[model samples]
Target: MKRASLLPAGIPIGIASLAAFATAMIGGTITDLGPWYDSLIKPDFTPPRPVFPIAWTTIFALCAIAGVSAWRAAKDSRTSDTVIGLFALNGFLNILWSLMFFRMQRPDWAFWELCVLWCSIAVLIVYCGRLSRLAGLLLLPYIGWVTVAGALNWEIVRLNAPFG
Candidate 1:
């Protein structure tokens, strides 16, 4: 038996990539780096400021690849639609976290939202795993990053609470 292409011809991986890029860009734009953010008391383990963009860029790229792979691998249109819906939901949660924490300057609220984000990642991993193991594997790093991010969000809230 022959293996199918990871991304079928005319499957529009470009569109998926573009959507992921847009999501990342929107999240980045919402993340403010001004006096308020600088004033927050971060934990010792917090990565250097420059590390964030690089890390997020890589993660988003992997997410796009995983999404396309899973979509292509889906055995039926219902499965493909499910993959698309899950990815769309994850993207929404991803951007919402940035808005909650950075734009609103409320790490407390962000911490709660990150819980939902983490769950979305886990769901993607599980569903994508059923479709394509490689796709699921690709999402591992994303969950790891989100784990670290959740920890950081919690610490920030702990260190600087009572937001206005």
Candidate 2:
């Protein structure tokens, strides 16, 4: 691929990822995340509050990198179109999960949305693995975190259901 084209490939994905990150951060600031979140009954396995931002920043960076990698490798036969589609879907779903969970503060709805997010991530890993092992590996923490998040969401739903 031409050098110019390669660079631009990162632009779209990078912008989208950055936008999502910014939206989440801004939403976090504007909303009453503390009271809503703190009032809920959390699980014993929950990580520290400070850990969330760090983990999410890392995951968002990896997500951008993966998109760039996939876009750059688009011409490679190994990078199937289906993989790209799955990646795009995962990105869109990632944004939605935060909106539903944090912004809306709907634990039950968030739990269901997170289940879809988890499944999409699993499929994305398999697809990206075929294109670039590193890309797939990059998303590992994201997948792990989301899996734990799903469990937490489930527990939250069970414990704080009907109102929480």
Candidate 3:
């Protein structure tokens, strides 16, 4: 038996992990749980403060795994490049949502932005699924969490409109 010739194993995982970490850090910085956020009327379903970090950490780990799996499974450089590009775009959108909601204190803006995030996730699921079923499946939890977040954002906007 001969070893298969594919892209170096660790590179994709490392790059993807680094990108995910950077995105997480940026989003975390933008997410201020200060008086402004605490003052908002959150939905009863809002998870405890501790839940956010735990949830995002788990999701980001899965994202890195999914990206690496998809890249490795790609048949050609073009496909792998596409996967990388999508993940990069998703990271940007992820940080933007945090900036809009937490930094800007505008859940209304973030709610709309969440729609774009949801679509990007959908694209990842579909395209990654095409490359690797497990990769696509891994993204399911991310989408579910984002769906909940979107609903929560919508509720916050509804509960407390006219944000300054």
The lDDT values for all models are: 0.91, 0.74, 0.92
Q: Comparing 2 and 3 by lDDT, which wins? A: 3
The C-alpha local distance difference test score for the whole of candidate 2 amounts to: 0.74
On TM-score, the stronger of 2 and 3 is 3
Clashing pairs in 1: none
TM per model? 0.94, 0.78, 0.95
Q: How far in Å is the alpha carbon of 56 misplaced in model 1? A: 0.5
Per-residue lDDT over 1-164 for candidate 2, one digit per residue giving the tens place of the 0 to 100 score: 43326455556676648764774565456445577888999899988988888888888788777655655555553454565577667766777777777778887997888889899988777776666778788888989999998998899888888854
Better of 1 and 2 by lDDT: 1
Better of 1 and 3 by TM-score: 3
Best first by lDDT, ranked: 3, 1, 2
CA RMSD for every model? 2.9, 3.4, 2.6
Output the lDDT of residue 55, model 3. 96
Residue 18 lDDT in candidate 1: 92
